[model samples]
Target: MAKKKATAKAADNLTFLKTPTGINGLDEITLGGFPKGRPTLICGAAGCGKTLFSLEFLVKGVEEFNEPGVFIAFEEKADELALNVTSLGFDLKKLQDEKKLRIDYIHIDKSEIEETGEYDLQGLFIRLGYAIDSIGAKRVVLDTIENLFSGLTNEGILRAELRRLFQFLKDKGVTAIITGESGEKTLTRQGLEEYVSDCVILLDHRVVNQISTRRLRIIKYRGSLHGTNEYPFLIDEDGISVLPVTSLKLDKPVSAEIINSGIPSLDKMFPTGGFYKGSSILTSGTAGTGKTSIAVSFADAACKRGEKCLYFAFEESPAQIIRNMKSIDLNLQKHVDKGLLKFYASRPTMYGLEMHLVAIHKAIQKFKPNVVVLDPITNLITIGSFSEVKSMLVRMIDFLQENQITVMFTALTLSTVINDQTDDGVSSLVDSWLCIKDIEMNGERNRGLYVMKARGMQHSNQIREFVITNKGLSLVDVYLGPDGILTGSARETQMLMEETGQVLHRNALGRKDREVLRKRKLLEAKIESLKTEFESAEEELNKIYIEDEIKRGVLNKTRQQMTDLRSGNKDI
Candidate 1:
């Protein structure tokens, strides 16, 4: 046994290697690319971008990886294939001239090809071998293997030939990508090629609410870790870009600096200066509760700080958003002109939920914004289930936080539902929650803002009155007097009534004091007049006494004086 173990086999056994697909996100989803030295089947319905994906994979291998590739098209001509990918900036003819790519358009006539007994597709193999050998292709793409079945109707011969083709490709040690139209129940039209191949990818093009979205899912990739989610893919000028739905677990430290929430008074409520950088702030309220306005104001604040911000408006167009923000006194056009703000407006049902996420992700990547605003995330619920939307938000928040980008999401809550549990299904994932409510008091609606929670920071628990004016968003001090939270038109009425009441009380007190003073002055004048009369009478009596005394001295000095005069006359 030891002697037998001493003998080692040659190390020439084929090992698993990934070939680059040249697509943006496809390599990440496939864990590098498809299995090297093996065939991969890509199946989907018509107009699902199967042919484009195949061509991108081959061209990417040739141009990027420096690996020669062979594109064997069964349906399309060479000129048509070349013209189609020109928009993607891929020049197939140039690659062929450089001896890096070999594109062979196999024109098969179904009526002419005779399927005899015990026949194999040796001619097809010979053609593929010639093309691969001509350029020494390390990567091969066979688009629409089903076209072979269409030309040859014999099932046994077709299956045998397909198995032989797979074996032939494997022996050649070339990584091949095979594309086919999707079948109703199987992975591919024939189903045999999918099983024979080492990898399988399914492409889907669906129109939900009139907006078409293309999605890619890896059904199976043998011996490789691949994403299973339906990734959103876009066919643009650069070629097909797939957005992987999974996230990596890299521990990136986030900033703790407090960033403003647009409204200064609102920012003052937070004890940590403001919300933490990379935090998720949720503003939820009933319709017309200024949810979108708050979100826009936050974006404006970020723009003022010279930080790039992105505004994703699902319910309003960019022009309409600008118009509405102007009414609130937030001039977003200035920020747009300064290159600080970017607005992306689309319908929630414009595509599927995944497509929306991809669009946002791509925009964020392209803009590298510091702040991201999603006005009324509830609109996303229109296209997806509650759990689906929640899941998407969780992923999105995680992505933003990982990138250290602050996020503000607004949600429109319905008044018919009472309770926090009935929120728009995204409140639990937020770092800060601001609930705006329309309180009906004194027969008028008032806007009240309250901080439900601010994680890792102390915040005021009191409900603050908020107003949206032409200047911007402001938090009026809480009305602590008789009236609570004076807002809307009622604030004016309350203020007017308060002023009138104070004026009336002052006028009534002034009148009472004036009346009391008038009566006191009348009494004082009467007493003084009486005293003057008494004094005058006393003086007159004194004068009369003097005159009588003089007359009584004349007449008793007038009586007493008259008595004295009488006594003096008697003495005389």
Candidate 2:
């Protein structure tokens, strides 16, 4: 008895089991997925993707989890539902034929049921239970609850029936999704549906400035924690993909790895020799400052390293960018041909900001690129305000960094307040900020590139002369001449003048050395002549002295003995 009690207590204490929906990024925000063996409410207005959401949950169960699902439609028949989902690449017919999926259409006459005062889901339970048992299904979806109870206006019967339906699904041990229309103030048309469901998700579709955006928010999760932010979702040829905004945390792993900035000279400006891996780089500049060139160069560098790069072009087509970069000696077509580079070009007006973000998120997930570039993000301003754009970018950067994907955005700066605000707002969120501006000097405008900020690394403080030539983008040190800092023709002129002065000074020094050499030779010749004359004089004096000594000796000998001295002298 004690063992039985302990076992029962353990089962009660165990966390609720969750069934993964298998939709990209949906399970992340749902914090595992919908509750297993319980119904989840997916409420939204018409065309807000409630049905698609439920269908995806069912299809993904079979596809990813090996769990068959039964989709019960109250509005559309099985054939209609199948045809509707065909475009999303869902092979519903094949799944049905293979017994992996089952579809049932529920029909009701609202007028007749109301006249008869008969409204109950007892028959629904029998039918749904049989379907679940037939395929041994683990997932179920009710395309809509509004049509199921359209004949009933009494709140008490609706509440009881809704509760009963939820309990029936729970008894069957199958996870279920129930769709509903949006109410005026509440999340669903049946105001109390959110209160009973284990999980309640709200979908919203709104148009601002004529651009439509679809967002999803979790209103309530009875026994689990979930993201509360309105995550943007995308519906394209692939199906539904939700971009979880608040799912990423600040503690995501970081890398000390370095990646090149495409330009060798520019990389030299950073102490790390390149940008940090997974870092966000913002290149902001005015018109004609070669911002796109910097982005393209970065992409090329990544592709050259045998890594994939995704380029999102807002102002130019892939062909246009490739053609223009060729002038600078960068061959981007090879990377594209090698499948290392992919380009997605679209105008900012193509969709709302959130849609753009979802599209980018989808592309990144599909391509799994190591590098991403958004050329001229300034074009996004046409669709949304600065704050909205900034918010979208923050979400995007957080997502990218969480995945350890390096991203670079190029922003066009102008003298007006709009461009300034855009750059200022975005620059703060980036890991590195490279500002390129025109430096008007020497009757010509030259580009000056400088690093405004680079987190976690040392960078150059001096503004470098940014030049675009046949060899691609390069940075050169600004010339320090008599005229402060100089670039372009002024720098060249100062260098030329300094070189000329150095040549003249060398020539003058050489002339002085030659003159000194000539003077030393002349002085040596004069000294030698004087020494020869002195030696001659000394020899003559010595000869005279010897003669005097001999004469004195002869006189003394003559005085002593004339004959004897003369004989001695003759003998000497």
Candidate 3:
């Protein structure tokens, strides 16, 4: 399966004959690199990092790709370039000593060289050829080819010779990178000299809102499809790193494993009992809404799970974060000591957005954490525009998800009214979004947390009261009464009042029940008394009738003597 996948990838990439540049993130954007054995023109303004880019390309070619390189510097000496790049950890002298690289500084002076007759750059060609043959170099870099215009007086001859040089390099079958100074109207300061190359990459250094940013764009690439979007780049201790803002696809593998949010109540809010592994979580809230506290809880939980975590604190120093977490009963220092937690603290203004991103990328590559926490990503908005910040976040989230690393980000919403939204515009890209804010009701403000959205899980829609104590953050049920939701001291007062009312209601119901029972018993006794009186009256009547019969019989006997034939006697 692995081999089949590899074959498929190869087939996808077979459209272009590319030579990998070995620069982080650049090769991916270019689909592989510059077209093989083709000259690519790199033009940019002064101090825009054109030189460093070409040098790194050649160096990487030698060290990584096993392609020997020849550097012909027409601007600076070999020693100067080497000294400038030493900090980037490139051992130029060592590479040269091993015959894997060669640096030839070509000095030109208008006063020293005169174009007295029609002449081609045959001597220059011989020199470059010798350097290439000596080291069997497969890569060549011509630093600022425009120097020929100053050295030679004839414009026609110089242009023709320059074209010949490009043709010669192509004939040599070596991938070459030619550096040029940027012009205001053209891709290079030398009007039409860059047209000879098949690919042209332009670098720019721009400052906006007092912050500096570097960008790269490809003007043209012949016979190959390339990305035309302007990519942000950064130059730091490592070297030039281009951050491509595109290629955020949804095809990355997702995991079914769930990771806890550290707070049991908060975890219970989600149907999965936790967040999905490799998912992006955005915690957005207003000030003092426990965004950082929530992020720290996640870090603590990850460390306790025996997983490594990276904490990026843009708003606070490491000491401040550690001390603040301690107050919440989160002892992050222990995790740091145990090598399970790493903290990278820097003010968001310390560098441009691209530099910060590059630093983060390098850290992740080096540390290989299972979880990453960005405490308060909203602070980055001060350095970049909203769209730029969103793009950077999208790229970061994409990278982490591709690696199956769960990431958490905290954002601050300045206004209480916008509590349901995110400030940096990255909320839509996250898999789970938890929004927290102050619920000001009954003349008091209390923290409230709710899951604004949790994709692929049935999350609670009720807003929970945020409670942070010495034991960390927790969610309590909000006070839902006739007056609507209440929190903080107001909720406490409402709860107390509700308890009192419930007690009184129970007492009243008990009294009413007892009264009803008493009335029922009284009615039963009255009916029984009536039944006894009726039975006694019937018995008296029966006795009277019996006595009457006896009297009548005696009377009838006496009357029969007088009237001889009383029917009564016969009847007797």
User: Which predicted model would earn the best TM-score?
Assistant: 2
Report the C-alpha lDDT of model 1 over 8-114, residue by residue, as the tens digit: 11222444577778788898898888887789888899999999999998888887899899999999999999999999899999999999998899988987776
Q: What is the C-alpha lDDT of each candidate?
A: 0.85, 0.87, 0.87
User: Could you tell me the lDDT of residue 367 within candidate 3?
Assistant: 96
- 284 in model 1: Cα distance from truth in Å? 1.3
- Which ranges of candidate 3 are over 4 A from the true structure? 1-16, 192-195, 419-423, 441-443, 481-486, 490-572
Is candidate 2 or 3 superior in TM-score? 2
Per-model tally of clashing residue pairs: 22, 0, 0
Q: Which 10 consecutive residues of model 3 have the lowest summed lDDT?
A: 563-572
Off by over 4 Å in 2: 1-13, 109-121, 149-162, 192-195, 416-422, 503-572
Q: Sorted on lDDT, highest at the top, how do the candidates line up?
A: 2, 3, 1
lDDT of 3 at 247: 69
Supply the global lDDT for candidate 2. 0.87
Which of candidates 1 and 2 is the stronger one according to lDDT? 2
Candidate 1's displacement at residue 418, Å, is: 4.5
The alpha-carbon lDDT assigned to residue 217 of candidate 1 equals: 91
**Candidate 2 lDDT score at position 259:** 99
